[model samples]
Target: MTIPLVTVTGKSVDDKVTVERTGFEEILPKLDGNPDTSSDDSVNPLERGTELRVTVQSEVYQAWGSVFEQRIGTDVDYDPSTERVSFTLDGPPTRGPPITRAAFSPRGTGTHIGKFAGTTCYRPTGGSSCTAADVYLKSANDGFANCFTIEGDLVVERLPDSGSLYGSPGCGGAVIEGQSFFGERLSRSSAYEIKGDVTFEGYTNIRDRVELLEAGGGVHFKDDVRIDGKVKKMRGVTVDGSLYFDQGSSSNELKIGDGTVIKGDLVAHGRIKVSDTVEVHGEIYTTNRKITESGGGDGLVDETGNSKPSSEIHKSHPLSQVRGEMRRDLTHMITSDRPGRVDMSAKEPATGDPAPDLTGATLDCDADGTAETCRLGAGTYKLDHLILGHGDELELDTSGGSIKIYVEGGVEVPKNAHIQVLGNNPNQVEVYVEGQGAGSDTFHMYSGSGAGGKVTTPQDKASKFWVYMDPSDEVRLKQDTSFTGVIYGPGNAPDGDGVDIYLDKQSTVKGAVVGNFEKFTNLATVKYDATLQNKYALAAGGAARGQVAYLRTSARVVSVDS
Candidate 1:
């Protein structure tokens, strides 16, 4: 439908004039000091207490005043004070339809036409304010016509089934200046873009491209997504499916969770950590580089690139010469009985011992809604201590996404309890335990036989689970428990009191184990997975860093009053 054209002339009129009509109705003031109603039968003569009914197409319009009732359709130019209606031949309204106040809350599946000066929230039911969890919109065409800035979040999701209020399932294009959340089975029909951080939670679907112009908070995708545009400037990202950054995205860090089969090229300036196995189709570029320049110099390799023997190379290379000097000093420390003399094997823990006692607030996962007796969903959990009782089976479910657990104290897994991860994809769980104080934190796994209570991830995709503990802490893997995953304890023997990792009573570790000091007793075996080195390599750079300089330099200042 075409927008009606209108024109207005004159400031005030003493007499009445005939309202004319072309192909469309035209409001002409009859200001000749007499009531003219001779030609048009639809309008009554200008007199006191007269009701005028004028219809232009199908729209019904009404204007409120003290004297008379005025009705016009489509476009009408009527001064509220003068009680006069005029028509213009101009184009569409110069500005969008003016709303009296900002912060509008629209109710359910119909179109709302106006330009909101402030925030616009969509709710399933009409209310005095917008405070609902989810809002549904069929389309955003007319509803968000000229709204360029929104000061708050735009939430669009499906209403609950029990509520009488409901809305259409999907929305059209939207450009929001604030954070956006599309949750709970809601879908976007066309391109959806946001200036702030955006999250897709609980099975929401996007039919077209989605873009984030400037997001400091990061984009978190808990479900699958196949987008057509680039995502930029996110601090970090955690994804469960194939993420294709079509235009090459940048982030400070990235975590590829389980079920992620394919990923696009990442230009990370910080770190890109993979949980399990991830197939990257594009190059992984990083800005962090150790050696900036390479050439021949004083006592180093020459530009001619001539090969030399190990003894000669060690004498010439600065780093190798330093290492040789350190080896000599260490040899003296080992042989001599000086005050600073060192023993290499002194840090290793004594054999055949259970884990240390754990003391902290108990975390009941079932009570906190994070887990049940049999199943646990993907989420980040913070706890004081972790304990799995005997004979209880707890399954970690990563089908929804990844799970990260952070403990401040210690962990205890008793005999006869089963804690296993259940998912097809690898690298779905990471457990981090920080030392509470000196000699207080420890990781203990009890020994048992014949269906013993063992804690383990999937054996085939053992690299998916990563356990990182403090350097001063002790980790004890008791008898009859087969562990599969990477164990990382950070510290060094000469520099500090290093970590102690003990494997006892025929326990086997399928993945690699790295600690400051490790001991194996009673036929325990550690079959290191050499391929894990390449899988979890600290490559050039992982995800691209945020372009803060570019964003600041590119922004233009505009007057808010204008």
Candidate 2:
């Protein structure tokens, strides 16, 4: 293979030397009819508009226009005879006068980023290095050979004793101030600096970050606030409405007035201390310090999926945490208890089985309902109906096993013995007893000191009733009272409503006669037959001292709900 010798026409170089583009130069690759290895005068790459292989050696480089090739004449002295190339430059360099604080046309192309002659007046003293000047950057197309430009003499004079550098009375128009000025947007009379405040009538957007040394008055943002500063202090930084610090922001101190309303979430890595109350419409979660509120409703939800009353939940944790804690507490209460309530309102198909008569029968619940035994085992015991003997106690002792007592129709425990129904979940226990057959009665849960015997009265629609008691053997009913399965017959019981305790004709009612009663006037000395039917009230032999009572009439007696 033949060697590829690269060379430039006007410039000769050693065999190891290479031609390349320098800083900010754009170069195009060589194409057909381009410079050859033995060419004399090199054509300008820009004028020829031919692709050229230029070694890139700088951070930026460029070369692309056909105009550069025309500038190189065919007989022009080219340095490297091994290469032929051409190029041309369109025009001479154009420069502009140094711009002062006075107004000037920023329309035409001009050198901007150059040393301008102006008194370097205000040299910040308190360790603040900031030069107050109308900075005009060089045009994009202009070659930035010099960074500073001065039409007059270069002077470094001490700034006159001035209190403030910007927005002062005499310093008006000297400060290039406006709400984001641009090329065609320069104001003619609005010199660089002005006397009055630099009013950013609308939103003032500085594409670059803004740094404030020390602002006396508060910096207000009708829209948003984005400041990068080492330390910022103000009486109050008020956002027109909501305030949001981006995720990356790490503010030292952020405080809101007493009644400030935040409609969004607040996330901060540093410490956030609220002086007074803080009302957030969204969730509030903090990983660092404490979050507090002065006073408000606990509109929180508990994990039970229950909407806790605003008056109950404490204002310590977030709503989610509060809810979780509540659910945990409830679960402990239900599972931890020795006998928790199992609402069996959904179990048991209704069967027309008669109530089990216990008048002359005895059962050892511990013997699997077959024989009498003291140790009751774990299993479900079904009694279609229960009829307590005139005077008997039902003893059920299940120490090692979990037993379930279920009565189909209802349960009636003689006032004599104490009854108990129990079960367990994974070793824990549950109890339920319902009374039935009669009107309505409650399950008497027997307590040690007459406090545990509970009588659960089933609703009129439900067939059975319940009585969860805790006694073992002996007990007795009150003299004139009888414990019925569904309804406890405290005959002529004075505790019932007046309308439910009325007396029959044989026994007069001295107090109010409350139950609904109908009078009859259609009996004309009726005669009796072989198949005769008659009804009569037993006579009270002359001594008619009435009793005070109420009877349940058309209205069925209703048990008071706890």
Candidate 3:
């Protein structure tokens, strides 16, 4: 290809010129190299200009049937810092059909600007596409390009290759706007590494092990993938589909959303959220990061100690109390007449009265039997292993103190059963406290006597203790059986101090009842449909069998004539 010859000279101050397009020889001689010798003959370079360097402002430069096209303006100006032949073209005109390729060393003194051969061809499939990177190597037909490296920011709207992108170690790090290298895999076997950032809005599938020494953006897998190396550290490793980490590969910061199925142990130094069911055969440990659900729901700990669904809760400041209080104050509630005065600590000590020394004492009901007309005084009591029956009631009139009730046992209160205290009426009750073993002092039930109603203590003041009730016989309840008390852990009397109440679904209970009363935790075998197995069921707020109607709370022999 014959080169174009054009003069490049600016005399004095009046030598400003403008042109749309021209050849390299027209401007090269005017830059700083040679003024007389043409830019095409490869003339022995001469001191082109002694004073001001000639400047050519043109949008196009052609040589040997090739054009270096620029978009807006091409202004050649003298930069005092470099004092070299310098010009700035507002980049190449967008990106059209690749016409030619030129190699130029932007810096360094005697750097050679080599000319390499290349093909300027477009994709036959029009628009743009890519290939999933595998393990093969690909190269452009550029003699100087295959061995050279590209530094600085190399932006590409899309780069679709069907082979591996091999970069010399000197390529340093090239940032790609889009992520997935469709058919071309990136191979760093030449000791070259991606030391910069790779922002992929798509999936990254590695046919071989990916050893990332430093990466800014997180590795996102938009589809199913298998990684083969240990992920040192990543911002957020998201697997939109399933992930199969090879034998030795592990992820550090993993964010697994719904539709993710992982086949390896995921170790994270940060929080991990899983919105779907996760089944892992490997161990998982979160040292400090809390696991939660991305979508909203109550946080629960499954039987396997795995965190259930819930939103993320940020950690509060350390060394501070991070607790949730379950308090509901009703101080402004109306009164149904102040309770009548009952002098429990009177000197006369009436018969069938609960001892005043029962304060700070514990009471427990028997598992095998029931306590009829049993009454208890105020005390910090632990009620366990017991069945309370026959109008059994516990009343407290202390001031400025609350009670703590913890029951691992079952409790029940029949209809119309009186468990509260009458104005001055009291009854004999047996209070039992379980032994904490050793000589820790156990409060035994009234096993060898008629009835006991006093509090047992090891000396005078007692702080911590348990209560074990005496084994008694059965306590039956007719209809209208009212008991104002608390019951826990339903089971047979021979089974220990737990209380069990068998009620038909038609029975009504008026007292506040909590805990699973259907004796669910005590069965030998659990059925698929959660059968009570001839156990008990409570019916409150009017419910009965056969009649489809509820019983009224008023006192009467409300008889069925049939």
The best candidate by lDDT is 1
Candidate 1, run of 10 with poorest lDDT: 544-553
- Ten residues in a row with the worst lDDT in model 2? 524-533
The reply for model 1, stretches above 4 Å from the true place, is 1-374, 435-441, 448-451, 492-496, 537-562
Candidate 2 per-residue lDDT, tens place, 367-444, comes to 132322122244345554443432333433334333344554434433333333232212211223333443332222
Measured against the true structure, the TM-scores of the candidates, in listed sequence, are 0.31, 0.20, 0.17
Backbone clashes (count) for model 2: 95
**Candidate 2 runs further than 4 Å off:** 1-218, 227-234, 241-252, 256-267, 275-287, 292-562
How many angstroms is residue 215 displaced in model 3 relative to the true structure, after the best TM-score fit?
4.9
Query: What total of clashing residue pairs does each candidate reach?
Result: 23, 95, 39
- Better TM-score candidate (1, 2): 1
lDDT of each: 0.38, 0.24, 0.25
> Taking the tens digit of each residue's C-alpha lDDT, what string does model 1 give over 1-562?
1223244545554465544333422233332322332434323233422323333322232332211222212245455454454442211111111111111122122223222222233221233543211212222322322222232334333221221111111222122333333322234343344322334433223323343332333344444343323222222344443343222232233434322233333333233444433333333344332212222321112223332123322111233322233211111111111111122133122321111221223444322323235455665555566666665566767775666666666776666666687777643566667646424437777755444446576544545566666666888877777666666553433223335666656665655444432334444544444334334411111011110100001122222220
Number of the top candidate by TM-score? Answer: 1
Compute the lDDT for candidate 2: 0.24
Superposition error at 561 for model 3 (Å): 99
- Candidate 3 per-residue lDDT, tens place, 1-562, comes to 1123344454333345443333222333333322333666543233221222223333332221122122212333443344332332221111111101111111111111111111111222244532211111012111111111221112111112222222223332222222222211234333212222232233343333233332333333444443333332222344454443332212233334332333333333334455444433233444334665544432223324466223322332121221111111111221121111111122111222223423222243322255434443432334332234333444432221222222223233432223343222111121222212312112111211222222212111111111112112111122322222222121221113222122221122211111111211111111011111111111111100011111112111221221
